[model samples]
Target: MSAYSASPSTPRTTSRTPTPPRTTVVNVEEFEMDGRSIETKSADHVPIVFKANPFKHTYPILRHTCFGVQGKQTCEVRDTTTNPMFRDMEEDDPQIQYVAKPFRSKSVQKPYRLRCGVMNYAWGKQSTDSAVAQWMQEGDPTYQVEQRPYAELWVGTHTNAPSYMQESTGSSSNLVSENSSFANQSLHEFLQRNPATLGDAHTEQFGTDLPYLLKILSVATALSIQAHPEKSHAERLHASDPDHYPDPNHKPEAVVALSNYKAMCSFRPLPEIAHHLQTIDELRALVHEDMVERFVTVVGSDGSSVEAKKEALKSIYMELLLCDSARVQQSIDAMTARLRNSTDLSWVESTFLDLTVQYPGDGGCFQVFFLNLIELKPGEGLFLAANEPHAYIHGDAVEIMARSDNVVRAGLTPKFKDHKVMGEMLSYDTQPLHIFRPNNEGPLTSYCPPPEYPDFKLLRVSLTEEWPGVSYELGKSSGCLLVTQGSATLLYCGKDCTIPTARLEVSVGSAYFLPSRLSVYFSRMTDFVAFIGECQIRAG
Candidate 1:
């Protein structure tokens, strides 16, 4: 039987008619980059349906290139002209890396989105009030840019910049930051005064230290093996090299697998790495005998020379990172050929080959075999703590971490490659492979797990049949809930609100903050994943 029944008879004793389901109404205000309020009249300049996803096969067709095609206009050019903000964006801009899509690989098994921050660029380009009119009514009337994107896809939120909407897009809520200070008022305005659950409150509380972080990852290739710095290393580096390093904040993160996830975790035992490093027949000829001997000496039988081995590896990494790409590729190719033929190749050897193919010239390709290989089934996850090193291989995962955007790159990237700095800042201490797991310790234990970073916690909420009817409470922590699968209704304010699974319906991008006092219920087709995290503020 349905949960809410129809009442044929009127409300007799109370003399009050049952309240009909109320329509969801979101109030989005306009603002400039400098944080000034603008009138809704300016919305014509920045139409709600500003731009759609640039990918071709995806719904709400995306514009990839800088040029506008026959029917579709290129968002790059449109963004440049319409929202002149891109000119100010530099590589060092906190928002750039803050919202960067770090997934890049050649063996991606499924479709993934890229450049979630691109939406922010769209928003920065023009106020919705001004751009909307130009894209829509200025054209052939009906042929305006009015199609909304999917909520699952990247749009706008505090984590990342909101993509300007050309049309009414997602099945979920639309996210917009009216003023610079993202507060409960904005949450109230976005969700239309609905009371949030405790989980919602927890996710909504991302404070001022680090306000937002979001990404839409597509794994076209397998990623290299790597991990991020803990708060200590990050702080030290930030203090040491203020110009080049990351902000000194904890980086505890969560990844919601958008597709099948494949990655490499920490290094295998020293014996394992040494054993594999020795068995390579072809590699023996490619590398110098002296270098090979050094590796053997460092990897003794007892594994007693741990510090020596680490130092040797540090030296080798420096040499390789400093060496020309051609030289490195030659060694990689030789190893690949040898591993391809040998059945006895060690796990590390095989991993090297896999990453080499995924990232041809990346130095990270060489480091793959030293780490643990983790293959995440759809909806499965692997978390990493501070100092725990890990690199994403292939597939799109919704990543939620602390507000700080400090990343010291080691390898497997075209953007930034700083081995010296990374080496100094990285935690070489060995640890277990399973970083993300259920917290057996805590007061608010409801499948919501706190990340390695004390500042943040990530909860993976998938509505299963077991949760046929689950009511998620909003804890004291403000939080954001990003739906990754299926459609569901959020029961709030004494009524049920339907949240569609379609991308266009959930255009609010990666964040949906719920306050502490409110609670919400979910009822939908099973198998929906949400990346819930604490927001930066608290409502007194």
Candidate 2:
């Protein structure tokens, strides 16, 4: 994992070649869609340098370069957030009178088939059952692996498991990474050069960075019982411990089920929790009597104000979570005996039995009562706001979130558990949470909108040949599209979205990075089911 938080700067102008510029073309993306061939074009225009001769123009594309003589080049890239220097420079030399345009405003990002890296955390599913493993196999036909835990397939500009562009010239393939390949840089570097991919709105809001992380998670065991801190808390944590809290950004995640999914998210009703504290001897014994009584009183009270009720809940919970462990376990053992006699089972009971078999007497086995238990079929989704605690119990999912990994784990894992931080960040008041699914819209058959997250947007598209022609503008911003099932034909169109440029073959596990400033239509998809991860970039 790499940690890079570079303060923005007015990067010095560099050249790909010597002064008398040499021109070269880079193949952005090329693939077969259905039976047709499609492709897009990008050319290196001109190089900028603080030089004398304004009249002599060696390089082409733009009529005039921004930098002429006089050493007055507008190269303040550091002021991207406030006042970006993205304008043309006027030529003062009497020898030539022409409009000199800066290359900064022109969209330079190109879409490509991306090569993503995988995270193999211990809580992953086996090779056959893992969605990430399946995709890896598809991404590389020669890739064959012995059995291993496959956790996450990450495709984004995140410092951890950052993705790379797949460049192909006939049989030879090139990959770009932190070690640097092709363009000699990482995805983050690419974004820095082409801020237009995020558009002017996102460029101003989030700078040149991609504000979201795209991931495919395949979990066999439960993830940690954790809550993501808001921006301020994240900043504080990162400032305190750079090792644990790597980034200083809030994380709000959206999970879409690729398989049968189960999770524990948010808090259940007050009455249901009080019942657990009453009926479960372990919980009652662990919590102080006065605290329990006050909780029960609040739950049963008719004339209690909202503030009083909230305080009652928090007060009781703090006591319970911070209870002495030796005595708490003794109470838990007694409660284990009581569970043998009980008939009805809550999430706490059912999950406790299953977890104890997996973890054996870990405290989180009983934490199920505090959070809502959710079950979702394929295509269902869930959105977790910052500070909302959640644990993925079982399932495969395509998850997207703000480009941050600021977790305060409390239980359900052997990893670091910071209850103090967790307590401060976690929100006690919550309603029963539900998964978000895409709604149907007309004509534009493939598009889905109003993504739950403010940073990034996503939708699962099951396109077929029968639907009326639908178009999406990937030409302006960057995005990731991973084909999950069947084969699809993507019609890569030209600048105006009028002519066919290239046909990319999208098969199961085939993932493509949508370039900035290139729009295309999945003109004819053959029962193609894919997840497209992209952020909304409002035009200036």
Query: Judged by lDDT, which candidate is best?
Result: 2
- Full-model lDDT, candidate 2: 0.63
**What is the number of residue pairs that collide in model 2?**
11
For candidate 2, lDDT tens digit of each residue in 407-523? 888777888888777766667875657567543442222222344455777756655443423445553456787777776555443333222334555667667666554554443
Residue-by-residue lDDT tens digits, candidate 1, 1-540:
011211112222111111122211123233111111111111112111122223222111111121111111112111222334334333453322111111122321110111123332211112223222222232224543333321223322343344221222222343221222323233323333332323343345532222335444445445434455666777877898767555776666656565666777666666666665676553444356677678777767466466777776656545545666777777777767767898886655666776776577666776665566777765555656665557776555666655555666677766566676656544544555554443222111122234324454455555544343333444454455555555554443211211111111221123344434333445444444455554433344
Q: Model 2: runs farther than 4 Å from truth?
A: 1-110, 169-185, 336-348, 440-453, 464-469, 494-497, 523-526, 538-540
Q: Which candidate achieves the best TM-score against the true structure?
A: 2
Query: Model 1: how far is 200 from its true place, Å?
Result: 15
Q: 147, model 1: CA deviation in Å?
A: 17
Worst 10 residues of 2 by lDDT: 1-10
Please give the RMSD of candidate 1 to the true structure.
20.8
